[model samples]
Target: MTNFEKLLDEQLSTLCFKPNEIVEAAVVEVDRHKVLVDVGLHTTGELKITEFMVPPSVGDYIQVVVDELDDGEGNLKISHNEVMVKQQLDDVQSLVENKTTVDAKVVEIRKAGLIVNVGYLTGFMPKRQASIEYVEDFTSFLNQVFKVKILSHDQIHENLIVSHKQYLIDEIGGEIARLEAPVEVGGVYEGKVTGIAPFGLFVDIGSHSTVLLHITDINWDLTKAVIEDFKFGDILSLRAKSVVTSDNGSQRICMSLKHMDMSPWEKAKDDFVIGERFKATIYKIEEETGNLIVSINGIPGVVENKDVSWTRMTNSNLNNVFKRGQEIDVVVKGFENKMGFESIVLSHKGCQSNPWESINEKFKVGQVLDTVVTSVSEKMLFVKVEGDVEAIVHVREVDWINPFEAIKSISSGDNVRVKLMEIDSSERKVSASICRTTEDPYKGIVAGTKVLAKVESIRVNSVHLSVLRKGKKLEATLPARYVNTVSRWLPSGEIEVGCELNLEVSMIMSGILYLKPDNSERAQSSFGTGDNPFAEAIKAALKF
Candidate 1:
């Protein structure tokens, strides 16, 4: 070596360069495999082409990090990737301290988090911090850029954690604050349904502010409502019913869809007049209240079970009379509209002609007509007379003898002649008598009149007998005294049903005949004892 060359080498060695030190270097030579850069050291530093993201041309200055002081071939080795990574870490640290955000691209997806590229260094975003909502598919965000805030940083450990949800909240927080002022109670706004739950629906009004629409506030008839009627992503006009502060000190809005529309009963008074009839369709029958929900001109009305029919129904099963989609005429009884609630009261029977209104015209006292027995009770017999009006035949008015026994003889659907004994139009009551159709047999019978009666039944103390007189049967009661008198002549044990006997009518009261045996001694004295003419004449008169 010459003296001047040796002097330049000694001068370059005085630059003071060490390994792992980042310094600015100027590109001196560029080749396909390596880029030679001058770091002002004893020798030029060489960087592999793979290390530089963008190829560096000659005379271009770039940041580089010293990886080794010398290679085995006496060359200085540096890395461009390591230098870029160090610069990015320093920038990210500054951003974290200042609470600033930066754009990051999702490069890879992992089970626990997403691998994102922030400038030169890779960052990690956990699944929970990815977005405000739950992320189902992380691959959808691959290659997508999002502004993120640094949640944590570990430069020594190379742990860079970022949150995309925090960035979204900060970005939209200003708009939400502006909306809170105008969102007062009773205000109306358009919102989109974001989620559906069993209790209610979640809707986003504006600026990503979510509110709840409770199930009760959705409609007036919750019994007939279902959650399936609504769906997610549906746009609905909602009314702000209330504002509540949550435990987290955040404002929550309670909305309503029903309040946005006028109530059905708001104009009910003008539309429904009492006693006026309107055709309506039965829509639903409430099992809880036993009320028939009918729609008249698209307005819902209720017809209680009591108002379903004029006749008292069996078990109040209005479902037997009214059904879904059935069209029937109903009369408006009344309506109420108060405090944002509306209801219309209706009656189905009121629209029909009242059978009691013309009851007197169709039936009169002492009118005898054929009727069909509809139903039988212990003390009364229900019969359907002319005009389909029901008249009750009480047990007392059923027969001249035992009224209860007469009820057993007739059954439902049996034909019988009845006389209308009483009619009350105001009370809507009609009473008939089955025995009054014939003439009274005791009208002309006088005391001491001899008659022959058949023993109907024999009791311990008395005997019940029936006599045929003038084609009418008359029931007579023989008292114990009279029965003993008869027992003297004929053994009481021998008295059987359908046995004939001679008796004289003693007294008649309250439609009952009192009888005694014809054993009067004065009658035997009038005609001498044997084969007495009076006795013969009495027997002849009785046709015994």
Candidate 2:
């Protein structure tokens, strides 16, 4: 304690003070739990930290009501909130009658507004009434004080409605006219950033209302600098692009930061040429497509997913491989000007050496390569060879017969061993065969070899038969026109898969076999209808 406070305490030791008396006190010390104040009595008074609308600091003066001159514990007690309620009830009875204003300290945050302690009552201040400026986070205003006029009151419930915005308007009188200044297109002016949105930034340029500085207009290369580079209250020199006013007296102004200076495209024409290689930075990645917009020498360029790599596009997952501001090599395909020099078409894959140039040396006909299936169709399977070269596996090449059935085992993302059958370097086409990876099942079998076959797949004009030779199944087609078997064994009538058939190898060439239904007497007898006269006599005797 100071010597002056000590002397004052000794002199006031005999002073008389009663409970419920309002007294002005100076804050002596304060902490998180309690506040100590000198009430000009023999002893200092204690007030809870929660009692004050706003926490008071040392040396501040506040009016409080004395609750008890001395408690049994010898500590003087006071109530700041009670004193405020008393003053509020005494002076401000009705807002309609008094037309009065009071200063309140922000004590709590709510969804619609801030909760504060108005003298003699608790009040609410709507968020819009707090300020004309946008408040991104209301929590930042906690514990601040504001002078507000009561808009509505419920004295019985100790509830008061106040507005700080009205207070500001009353204080600023004619200065509000500055917002009505006219804004002309192409005129440069300073703007203050107020809020950030997904599509753009909201800034105030001293017009009737806040304007939008669109994301596209914020930078020459949209991805070069991210939206996070800016913050609220940042001052920017911008040019007014367009202004529009709504029927409801609302105004919207569009501004640009890029137009404040000359575009880089103007100088790119002299420094760069078409069909040349140059280094570029990834500007942005399309969220829906795997397309890239790269910047070269500060000039924008487009790189589609097809030009990104030799691999085919399945999804917009290129963002996982590339990032904004990353440096990459690209080929300047061409430039086009629409209104202005919009962008130059670029190809990142073109900058690399083509793998097809050495196709003959790297692979040969019938060379087996590990392949992954890309997609499956009824008649063909698309696959990637060595994870790069795109190749097709026709169903006919997958198996000698029943090729469609073999296709069901292969699907997208499945690994299969296939041999390259044909490679057309000029067409950039590759034909592969999945069945040829294994040995031919009919290696030693010659033409005219009779074998037992099963109907594998039925067709309109013919039926595919599976012939087993040397414990391996080979495919053979039996033509309906060539079938000369017994009437009961006709393959064209109602042949089903798994039905056994007596077939003769009529011809064999180029790994394909032609079969004719057997017509031999032994073959016919084995499949013909059966009847006996002895069975008929036995049935006649039983009927009598």
Best by TM-score: 2
Tens digits of per-residue lDDT, candidate 2, 269-322, equal 666777889999887887667788788876778888888866554342254457
Candidate 1 residue 124 C-alpha distance from true site, Å: 60
lDDT of 2 at 259: 70
Reference-based lDDT, each prediction: 0.74, 0.73
Cα lDDT, model 2, residue 166:
59
- lDDT of residue 300 for candidate 1: 65
Best by lDDT: 1
- RMSD vs true structure, all candidates: 26.8, 16.7
Taking all chains together, the TM-score of candidate 2 against the true structure is: 0.41
TM for every model, in the order presented, reads: 0.39, 0.41
The digit string of per-residue lDDT tens for model 1 on 229-311 reads 87756778888877767788677677878777664445656867888999888877888777787777766678887787554
Count clashing pairs, candidate 2.
2
